[model samples]
Target: MKKSLLIGATALALTLASPFSQAHRVWIKPSTTSVSGDSEWITFDVAVANGIFHPDHFAYPAERLSVVSPSGNPVDIQNQQKLRYRSVFDVELTESGTYKVFNASQSLVAFWKDEDGERHFWPGRGKTGTVEEFYQAVPQDADDLNVMETANRLETYVTLGAPTADNNKLTGKGLELKALTHPNDAYTGEPIDFQFFMSGDKAQGTKVIVVKDGEKYRDTAGGVEVTADKEGKISLQFDEPGMYWLEAEYEDDKAKAPAKKRRASYVLVFEVLPL
Candidate 1:
């Protein structure tokens, strides 16, 4: 009877945890996508949840939020707020070009036991390392072992003046989605193309999730999946004007070995304007 109860509880835990875990994506949303006047202040909110713009989940801490100016420098924000639903921060639009708001967190610890009774520990952060480097850090006596690392990296951009295709400013290490079409200048009914890169190389076989922000406060998207071509490209078309979030995930199956799995996630938030 005790064994049966234990198994039942475990099943219940997995059932409840699956949806929550799958939805825990981090994203940032600015108050406006493009600014033209003398307005120098922009307010934004940041959150970590399945629903990108929805405030149903937890907000990212202030320390995790940051801004990069148009002149290639980090800028400070004010009116900082944090709540269960979402965290809010305000930035002064000092420059006239495109401004970037970003948040990156450290890798946490994740562990699981496989059918073979082997335990695996991986960093809960976003993509961080090569497959060999990942397993090399694991202890050989990893029978009840732990070997892995996962990290979360998120970014969003706002145009201060005329929109430009300045993709080079957003380039960096790890998994990134480069907008082939100028993000802020996109219009409804137009396809927004993005290129995916893992560790600076076109990452093929990556899975992307695209969802339109809804009014009711839910993370339900039925999830749209798209595959990257040989050159690591994927796109989505907006039928109407509204906000949207895109998330890409890639797993190193060949590197998992006898272990469970190693994967990375990247997220982007953009808006579509009406024609």
Candidate 2:
């Protein structure tokens, strides 16, 4: 979907009430984030006032939310907020760019699982949303007046996290979520569709486990195992969608240097929305 379209939809979701739309509230999972150095722009969080707006209407709920820029240009996102479970966004923040959050609509989102004993993306589980950016432009000085040059220069961004007035905050560092995906949204009597990404450490073979909606079911049979590619990317698909908690535990012993050692972990929350 187009960024403008997503922005419009986001506006309507928070500003109005409708049968098709769910209520939401704004809160930041991580109160703050950092960047490398002076760049262009930065990205962080802005609190919303909605209850909790999840694409499924219940699970993975993130209330009415939308992002806008200083130029009055509504920003585009991962096209997945509606499908918070299976979507991700690269929020930009730098000198070249500007970051200001509108607000959130509702409450803390919770995770859910499907019936096939698989875990999916969970909301309100305290996940780390990526804020990528650097500074892009220099502020104008009264002594040096150059409007044309300023307009011509491109906006830049850098990574950073800020807080909204609401004070609803979620923050930490490193990868917050373990690799996991939803097997099904509702329930699945047949094969389900599952997919996820993991970032912990380098172990021989990673074990994927799932906890069904508050239930304990271990499908370690042909056990859902995953292997990293050359670029450290792994994905799996399920036949259905359900509330589940996907986790991975690995250790990197080959690292003799501090930089090579593993320290942080991350889990991506997202679900497949009806396209």
Candidate 3:
């Protein structure tokens, strides 16, 4: 998927070597600027290498956090508590765009204790690393800032559209499964609904089929035309559930002559977990 990948870079003035006489500065890790799509997890690791909490510290520190839009409006944020660390909020981007994640102290740093038994003070609130998604507008989640001459690091973006009320949708060039339901994940009894729909701009005659655990059926998805309204739709049952693979077939455009032209199909892996 050729989703726009906006590259942005941020710099910090607080040096790692400096000593904190007081709650010094806030920092984010993996300073690599570009985050990998899969390996992309942001962690707000606080510095506790020194400064133990003293009794005289002010009320527990406030780590007020929120996502700041490109235009500078504060979006609604939600609190998140994960096993590793508790985050004040998370901003999820659905459409690709530019945005910024803003974080600050709710109050001056002090002392605190999380679900974990460890009682912390000073930069105590720093350990809460999990930030739940707030706004979701992607490929729009941009820190979109700079122009890089050459970016050695690349984030592979996957076009995963949310399942519509009908359950299935296609990303034109690829298969998208958001609202599919599998009643028989084990493939034991009567088949159930694993419905979905898709379409493309190119008028490529494509075919979609449902294949069972180990069997094959010719009754492929019948009316998946590349036309405007009559795009591809999947609404069928399976004999039994185990792991049914939805295979899409199209005349292989990449196949050269002389050599037997192979059919090109995209296999959307699906499963029906037993209830």
Candidate 3 residue-wise lDDT, 184-205, digit = tens? 1223444443322222333234
Of the two candidates 1 and 2, the one with more favorable lDDT, higher being better, is 1
lDDT of 1 by residue, 97-190 (tens): 8777775432323455666785444532232344565456544554555433343457778888876555334344556777788778779888
Best-performing candidate as measured by lDDT = 1
Positional deviation of residue 94's Cα in model 1 after best superposition, in angstroms:
2.0
The stretch of ten residues in a row with the least summed lDDT in candidate 3 is 147-156
Model 3 spans > 4 angstroms off: 1-205, 214-229, 251-264
Model 2: per-residue lDDT, tens digit, 1-275? 69566555544333221111223322222112333344423222322222211222222232333555434456654333433332233455442323333222211111224455332221112222111110112122222221110000001112233212111112222122222322112234432332222232223333333332212233332234554443343565545443322333332433222113332222212222221
- Sliding window of 10 residues with minimal summed lDDT for model 2: 147-156
Candidate 2 lDDT: 0.28
Residue-pair clashes per candidate: 13, 109, 31
Off by over 4 Å in 1: 1-21, 105-146, 149-151, 167-172, 215-223, 253-262
**Local distance difference test values of all predictions, in order:** 0.65, 0.28, 0.28
**Which regions of candidate 2 deviate over 4 angstroms?**
1-223, 253-261, 272-275
